[model samples]
Target: MRKGFLKNRFVRVKLPALLFATVTVNRGLMR
Candidate 1:
């Protein structure tokens, strides 16, 4: 359970960066 909690926290930390990267890629492709 503790391991899963740490994994979830790691994802929560990374999710925004991933999202931002994807959005930037899409915008670049659109241009």
Candidate 2:
């Protein structure tokens, strides 16, 4: 149960951060 909770929290935080980083890198390449 605790492992599941930590996994959920990790996804909630890292998912958006990874997405944003991807977007920023793409934009930089497009320039």
Candidate 3:
């Protein structure tokens, strides 16, 4: 249970960060 919670927390934090980074990179490339 604890491990799952940690995994969930990690994804919740890192997923958005990764997505934001990807979007930023795409925008930079578009420019």
Q: Which residue pairs in model 1 clash with each other?
A: none
Q: What is the C-alpha lDDT of each candidate?
A: 0.98, 0.98, 0.98
RMSD of each: 1.9, 1.2, 1.3
Candidate 1 on 1-31: residue-level lDDT in tens? Answer: 6999999999999999999999999999999
By summed lDDT, the worst window of 10 consecutive residues in model 3 runs over 1-10
Better of 1 and 3 by TM-score: 3
Identify the runs in model 2 with alpha carbons over 4 angstroms from their true place: none
Model 2 TM-score (2 dp): 0.89
**Most TM-score-accurate candidate:** 3
Which stretches of candidate 1 lie above 4 Å from their native place? none
Clashes of each: 0, 0, 0
User: Which of 1 and 2 is the better model by lDDT?
Assistant: 2
